[model samples]
Target: MASSADDVFTAICGGTFVYPAVMHEQYQDIRVTNRDGVTLGSIREITYGHAISRMVSRATEEITRIDHTSRTIESRFKPNALSTFNEFIGSDLLRDPSEVVGQNL
Candidate 1:
């Protein structure tokens, strides 16, 4: 059975044939070749640990860009929402709500 890494390598290499990998070395060299055995490119193995970190970093960057774009689009419709929120917090609404019953008792 081909491992997940092998699948990923095969996909990245544009549907090329992935040669039988040698497992002795610290890294797995995925020889990318066409159907007729023409070498296309070299695929290097990434450890599972490093792959997780790289995936997380990439996801975080994409999420940040999405969040920023959405916030900008929303702000265009409600430009004063943020400032109003800040003003409300800065005002005495937090200190005295006028509905509390007994405070000095």
Candidate 2:
């Protein structure tokens, strides 16, 4: 599952063709050090948002945009997701870029 702030990349109704390689060398430090848990992306999206008008209404907890050519990514996290994130990661370290501050989570 390739997940981003706004999208969870899945094909054929979310079935995976291959493992995500959680044990890859480059990701070793992340998995090895943060044994307890992990949260991805910048949380600056936690408090900001934009409204889009549509004929069919829907609800969302987050929003994200990526510009490959410009090499930029943006995300917005709503109250529920933010609160949940803070609860999971703790409220004390609710900074812009959410990160692993300690070893073994």
Candidate 3:
């Protein structure tokens, strides 16, 4: 449903590369052009593979934080009585699906 954030920003500003979510209902924006002529094999290399994993994580996190119902990300606008202070919490994928793949590799 969501597009990967790989081509988002520069390296200094941490980038994310989201993976495909076949079950999602929304359609990703079409980007058919090959800007740098990079092939699928090149993108599947270790560096890019890692990037994709990280992007998928960011997309999930952003969704949770942006979704008003989720309340996963702490917000400063929240009533000052909920807790001592709002905290920024990043996603932690425990026992990830890719964990097995990494171990085997």
Q: Name the candidate that leads on TM-score.
A: 2
Cα-based TM-score, every candidate: 0.15, 0.21, 0.15
Query: Looking at model 3, which ten-residue stretch has the lowest summed lDDT?
Result: 41-50
Tens digits of per-residue lDDT for model 2, 11-83: 1123222212111111111111121112233222112121221111111222245444664444342333322
Model 1 gets an lDDT of 0.21
Q: Summarize candidate 3's per-residue lDDT along 1-105 as a digit string, tens digits.
A: 112224322221243233343122111121222222122211111111122232221111111122225422221111122222112121222334344222222
What lDDT tens digits, residue by residue, belong to model 1 across residues 32-77?
Answer: 2222111222223222111112110000000011122332211111
Cα lDDT, model 2, residue 39? 26
Candidate 2 — number of clashing residue pairs?
1
Instruction: Determine the C-alpha RMSD for candidate 2 after optimal superposition of all C-alphas.
Output: 16.0
Q: Candidate 3: lDDT of 75?
A: 14
lDDT of each: 0.21, 0.24, 0.23
TM-score between candidate 1 and the true structure: 0.15
Of candidates 3 and 1, the better by lDDT: 3
Can you tell me which runs of candidate 1 are displaced by over 4 Å?
A: 1-3, 15-45, 48-105
- How much does candidate 3 score in TM-score? 0.15
- RMSD of every prediction: 25.0, 16.0, 17.5
